[model samples]
Target: LKAGVVEALKTVQYMGIPQMVVTSTRTEVALLKLARFNILSYFEDVLGGDQVSKGKPHPEPYITGANRLKVPTKNALVIEDSENGVKSGVAAGCMVLHMPDLINTKLEWNNVIYGALDSLESFPEWLSSKQFGMWV
Candidate 1:
């Protein structure tokens, strides 16, 4: 697993920040992966590729996620690790934070992204910074 995923989830849980998985992976497969990693309980919901007509870069997934959480897209904060995910979140009107996974983030995205995270491990600090005025 990537570093600090458990800690990040715990931090968010402690802060009462709701989260959901909006992944291109299938729901069943994603659920199994989350279960295998023992992080299934951290998410409020999971929107899989199979569950949505459109996937990343289409905004449908992120839009559906925010709708499921009963929050407006403008109020949602999307932490993405891929270019397409970032594009989708931006297209959905949510604040997007790029945490590069295998691919290096595009420099041009700096103009559009709300913020950038070095890794998921840094989520606590990022949230605590209050740049976007997080409740916690």
Candidate 2:
């Protein structure tokens, strides 16, 4: 996890929001990493590629996350760092906020992206801003 991710997650939890981890990594590896970071409790569920029939760029992973969270796909918000992840979220009918960790330019899939942020630290403030209302 990033420096402010835990704080952001805590804020979300405080606000009574439900969160789930949907990653392309294997289930055991993802759980191990989250446990190692001591952030496993922050998520209501942790889903991995192995849990789904298909991986990123396919909607299965994110759809499974929404199902596990008991939230409608349209009501879910996906924070993604990669094109494949963004695509998966979009395809699953979830709002995707792209904060690319590697790429510097806009992706060709920008049309589906709900918003773009410079860093994870901005996520909490962004969630509280009027822009979030407009987007949602």
Candidate 3:
């Protein structure tokens, strides 16, 4: 996790917004990471690779997250770092915010991405902005 991510999670939690972690990693590994970062309690649910039949670039993982959260897929916001994760989120009907990490290439499926963010530190401010209101 980034420096401000925990603080952002705190703000989100304080606002009573529901959050879920949908990852390609195994459940145990995901949980370990969350625990290591002391962010395990922020998420309402964590759906990992083993929990889904298909992985990234397929809709199954993100769809399962939305279903587990009991919200419509269209209402979900997925923050992803990879192209396949972005595809999964888009395929599941969720708005995806891409914060590119190791991958530096331009996204070919530009239409599918909601927006590309500069950093995770901007997430909280972005969420409070009018543009984010339009998204919700």
Local accuracy by lDDT, each model: 0.88, 0.84, 0.83
Error of 1 at 4 (Å): 1.0
Candidate that scores best on lDDT: 1
1-136, model 1: which lDDT tens digit per residue? 8898888888888778888999999999999999999999999999899999989999999999999999889889898988899999999999898898956788999898898878988988877676444432
List of clashing residue pairs for candidate 1: none
Clashing residue pairs found in predicted model 2: none
Model 1 scores a TM of 0.94
Query: Root-mean-square deviation of each candidate, in angstroms?
Result: 1.6, 2.3, 2.0
TM-scores of the candidates in the order shown: 0.94, 0.90, 0.90
RMSD of 2: 2.3
lDDT (Cα) of model 3? 0.83
Better of 1 and 2 by lDDT: 1
Q: Which stretches in model 2 have alpha-carbon errors above 4 Å?
A: 105-107, 130-136
Candidate 3 lDDT tens digits, 1-136: 7756877787677666788899999999999999998899999999999998999989999999998888888988898888799889989999888877856526575777777777778878877663444433
Off by over 4 Å in 3: 105-107, 131-136
The best-first sequence of candidates by lDDT reads 1, 2, 3
